[model samples]
Target: MRLSATSLEQVPPGIARYSYHRAAQDIGIVHFGLGAFHRAHQAWYTDLCMDSGERGWAISGVSLRSPTVAEQLNPQDGLYTLTERSGGESTTRVIGAVREVLVATEERETIIARLGSPGVSVVSFTVTEKGYARRTGGSLDLAAAEASFYPLLTDGLRLRRERDLPGLTLLSCDNLPANGRELERLFGEWLTERAPDLAAWVAAECAFPSTMVDRIVPATTPSDIDALENLLGVRDEGAIFTERFSQWVIEDRFAGPRPRWERHGAQLVRDVAPYETAKLRMLNGAHSALAYCGLELGHEFVHQAIGDPMLRGLIERLMRQEAATSLAPAAGQDLEAYADALLARFADPALNHRLIQIAMDGSQKVPQRWLETLAYHQRYGEPCPALIEAIVAWLRHVRGDRRPVDDPMAAQLAALWATEGSSGIAAALFGPQGLFSHVWRADEASLARLTRRLG
Candidate 1:
């Protein structure tokens, strides 16, 4: 038997199961990129709200390019198991917040209808950094704009406007800096170019709240699925595994009502900048450092990397010193404690967080994770050799033989390395036409520092 509405009762007694009235549920949220991280993070938070008697906020997840997620989820009646593992103990829970998943290619009209519904006041996104289809300088690649999600979002909002419906809160739950603002800017440019008139209405009514979401959802393996079957007494095709720790900090700028996510461990605040910066720099920055450096040292997983004294030392110093020092923490924010917690989370052996997984999108990740910190040091004449070393490692990673460099700019980066001398690779990538979103590049002094360490 597969885990579904029918198999709900068969789940083991020790495992948690939602008792929400699915029949009365309304799919008000339309989340894009229904990936494992979304399932583990945002969808799980909404699931908790449902258990606590919240109504009308069930998610209608949209998998943009692939039907694979839809196939895995829809068959199981949008049912999936989430396992939170810590130390050696694990907890299993069935998530019921997602009502259905729509593959965009197949169900475009239906998705547009849902998006235009007044009841769907929230259209959230967890599309990875690459999903925006952006250029190196953070603007939408206008040529690719038609195929990107923003145009689809424009169609949805246009329908809503035509039907005299109010605008929805456009929440961006990605790891980009000021993600909400970037999302708005990117979409604004796209909308202005495509649907010039709808821009003003969207500007006045819609809300794009910045959010900081934290969770380590490792890619589920076949063994994980088998383990879940043994624990649940049934198979669950959409099973996801994650760490015990999860946090969401959203800017309180909703256009209307939203889940009382704050009641269930989420933090609603005036500004998410401080929290987001800390996470991006200390947590995400160190993550990239670990990814690139760990791969160089023959480490496979996060725990393995952290277990290596040399890797751990570099990351710890990177987080607490290089990354932490760059941030202007808000009142009551303890960056050191945050760094300590991150270190602990990274060291959790149960997560099985792959270095290559974190390393996948180097071109999109490094600007926010490593380059900004480097830029900050450049401004202050401070030394962040830790970050520079990470950048160098990433440069080497982009030219590796073990696996394909899994980045959007892989071809361009490979070409840069193939044509440019390695010693000049640092200068070439940070030069006037550098293929990065960051405005800052290495000066002569910084270039010398980076070049001396590389080929």
Candidate 2:
């Protein structure tokens, strides 16, 4: 039988089990994006909190697009296996933090009502980079935005106001820079233009707190599921696999009551900028570099790419020399040590982190991951050789002839590549009207250099 509440007794003794009474805890958080990362990262942290006797913090997960996650978790009674692997060994645990899964399109009213509920104080999101639906400059792209998400959030807030409920904190756990501020600004733009009164109320009452979340969660495979089922003696459809390390740094700003997340290894700091920036430019930037450059060199997984001497050298240089240089010096942040730890993590053989998965949505990702570092170098008249190579690799990868470029701007990128050819594509891509034009439109010298490579 599948791993549902009734099958809890069948689970083995060695595997960590959820002992809490699931029916007693109220749903205090409604998280938007029920992806594997959320299940392995935030949900895991929440599970720890509940185990430590924290009440009223069970999560109600919302899937914005596919019904796949709801289908996986709902039948399992929101009970799933979390396998944390390290050094060729694994530890398994059943996470009972998630109480319900709702497909946004199917249960819009239910989500809104939950958001308005007095018990729910925080509404968090992990909807990936493109899911936020922002244009090049971080303004809300109203037309391109999903009615099920953005407008639905606005309607939810309006309902809260109507019901006289306390303002809820809106938490953004994405990789974007200043994620919390961006969320507030995007919603502010939408609300101000549509309903000015509601905008005013939100500005005064709600909290948009920035957060930095880090964990390496590779997509689980059927083989992995079979292995885990053998260990548990019960199949878990919503099982997730991740590394042993985890970090969550949240800016300590909330509109109302929130979970004591800090009690369970989370950092509640006054500012998350330093931590956020370093992770983006170092870890994420290196990942993108490895993705594009690794794929170009015909490597499949992160462990394989990191083992290659050339790719390893490029990423080390990209982290220590280029990305770390771009960040301002901060107290107690040993960026050199941080770089060392990242390299070690990258080389973990147990992680089957795919290059193509990281390579997806390059048009949406490169701005913070690589382009921002390039921008910083450009400002100081410094050279970023590794970054230049990675950018060239991305320019080549987006042509969409070999592997698929799973991006929202795929058609436009392919059209540019087809129409311009090698002689003109580099200039066209970095030119004023290009996909990355919003972040650092290249000067003539930069264009000429890229053209020479293509030549």
In candidate 2, which residue ranges exceed 4 Å CA deviation? none
The Cα local distance difference test for each model comes to 0.89, 0.88
Q: List the pairs of residues colliding in candidate 1.
A: 136-437
TM-score of candidate 2 to 2 decimals: 0.98
Runs with alpha carbons beyond 4 Å of true place in candidate 1:
none
Look at candidate 1 and tell me the lDDT of residue 156. 93
Error at 104, model 1, angstroms: 0.8
Residues 13-65 of candidate 2 have per-residue lDDT tens digits of 87897778899999999999989999999899889888988899999999997
RMSD of 1: 1.2
Q: Please report, as a residue range, the 10-residue window in candidate 1 with the lowest summed lDDT.
A: 431-440
Clashing pairs in 2: none
Clashes of each: 1, 0
lDDT string for model 1 (1-455, tens) is 88888888888788888888887999889999999999999999999998999999999999888998999989889999898999999988989999999988888899999999878999999889998888887778988766657767888999999999989999999999999999989888988898899999999989999999999999999998987788789999899999989999999999988988998999999999999999998899998999999999999999999999998889988998888998899999999899889889999999999999999988888888888887888798887878888988999889755577889888888888888867878877886566652556777877787788875
